[model samples]
Target chain A: MTKERKPKPVFIEGAISAEFIGNSIAKHQSKTTIGAHDIFLGQVRADQIEGKTVKAIEYTAYEDMANSKFHDIREATFKKFNLTCMHIYHSLGTVKAGEICLFVFVSSPRRVDVFNAIEYLVNTIKEQVPIFGKEIFEDQSHQWKVNS
Target chain B: MTLKIKYFGMLAEITQCEEETLSFSKGTAADLLKVLFEKHPILEEKEFQIAQNQTFISNDSIISNAEIVLLPPFAGG
Candidate 1:
């Protein structure tokens, strides 16, 4: 039987810390049924626009819609994959260029499930979610970021 | 009807506010866009999508008394 999972908040205030990521992995140790784990982390890139360099990214979202889309994605993923568990987190406010902004973790009983699930989750989040980012430059000017 | 319109990302920057309530006449989503375009002409040049009550709607969809959102191109990871 498929278990129903409640949707949890996914937005973090700033950068997702390494410590938090480590703790999440540690917490999954008790779930012995999972043998393979796949992790994807998205870091802010300091791209050069003209002569300016990006310093940080400020993120915003249509909260209600984004959350609903995330929930739908989660449901669809569970139906498509034979995975044990999954977690997704994205930054809300400003995150420095070198900091982490998005983290996706998926675990399953076998390696193939995790490998495929991680790709789907990350790609879907980028294409479907209503989150936006402002690429803030060092001189305080900014440009909107669009997924390629 | 008073429609609450919310703007996100670059749309908000162009609109100069996150949200505002406007008194709109009953019409389709395209009609509402005409009114918004007159007020914020720059918006016509930008690319975006429209959502009503958190659901994406096409241009011909009828507008009701509900929350509307203007969303730019998504950049999430």
Candidate 2:
């Protein structure tokens, strides 16, 4: 009998570390059937607004809805792409500028599937996910972030 | 009926609270907005989407669920 897969938790409390990402990759080594892998990392940019420099981003979410939407996106991606596996992670709490906030990993047996799948996944996450970011300036002022 | 409303992102900032319950005797999403605008007049100037039971709706949809969420522009990557 095939094992039923459960949805992985997408939101973590802080920035995604390089060690975590490296370990994720290492775990895939045993799955020798995958020939190509693609990754997308979204970093918090220190954006300057109105002459104020942002020092960190405090992330928040409609957690229930965001997770459901992520599940839908994952299912849709699997239906549309020939991906061997996929993983998505996003930060929920404060992440400083220059730290990683979002990580997506996708694998496929061929390179073309991964090249197109990564772009689709990234764009879909930006458009559909119910996650918010507050840009905190060095002076303690803050502004809400909007996707462009 | 009492409706549970959650405000997120910039909307939360404007509302100054994340969630609250509104005793809405009137029906549907538009009616709720009318009452909300009466309280938070500044919301009329802001752009957002209303989700009923986690599903987004436009104007004049009947509200069948108490769980409503106000979502501002999505900034997630």
Candidate 3:
């Protein structure tokens, strides 16, 4: 039976630690009906631009609007896929290079649904959400990051 | 009527403030842009989309909402 889910807060203050991700996976262990699981992690890359190397990224968002958009995405994903549960988390503040900035987890009775749902959720979040990233360079300079 | 306007991302950098209130009587989104452009000329050169009531609207869309947002290119994952 599909369970009705409410929109939960998705923004984290800083980098999402491995411990948090591990705990989340551990929590799902009790749900034996979930036959497959899929996860996606977005890491902050040290990109080079204009000869300056990025050291970290400072993220910001239109919180109320972002949360509303996230809720819509969650609802749509649930409608499209036969998933048991899903979770999404994104970093709001400075996330250094090599740190995890976004985490998406999905589970279902089978593998195909989890795979498709993960892709849709990540792409929709990237294209539609109002989250902004300011790339901080090693030299202390910065520039706005645009998804390419 | 006073409208609350919000600027996001690079657009906010140009405006120097994340949000503000402006006194505007009646017009389309284009007319509101004219007033904003006059106040912050640099905003005219920046690329952005206008949203009202959390939904994107065309330039000619009538301004009936009390809140508007200027959003630049999104960089999210």
Best by DockQ: 1
Residue A96, candidate 3: Cα error in Å is 0.4
Q: What is candidate 2's DockQ?
A: 0.89
TM-score of 2: 0.96
lDDT per residue for candidate 3 within A1-148, as digits (tens), equals: 6566788999999999999999999999999999999999999999989899999999999888899999999999999999999999999999999999999999999999999999999999999999999999998989999988
Quote each prediction's TM-score: 0.98, 0.96, 0.97
> What tens-digit string does per-residue lDDT give for candidate 1 at B1-77?
99988999999998898898898989999999999999899999999999987888999999985689999999997
Across all candidates, the chain A TM-score values are 0.98, 0.96, 0.97
Across all candidates, what is each one's fraction of true contacts kept?
A: 0.92, 0.87, 0.85
TM-score between model 3 and native: 0.97
Give the per-residue lDDT of model 3 (tens digit) for B1-77: 89999999888887898999999989999999999999999998888889998899998999999999999988887
Runs of candidate 3 exceeding 4 Å displacement: A1-4
lDDT of 1 by residue, A4-108 (tens): 789988999999999999999999989999999999999999999899999999999988889989999999999999989999999999999999999999999
Give the RMSD in angstroms, all C-alphas superposed, for model 3: 1.4
lDDT of 2 by residue, B1-77 (tens): 88888899999899897899988886878888999999889889999999987889987898778888999999997
Judged by DockQ cut-offs, the docking class of candidate 3 is high
- Candidate number with greatest TM-score: 1
Better of 2 and 3 by DockQ: 2
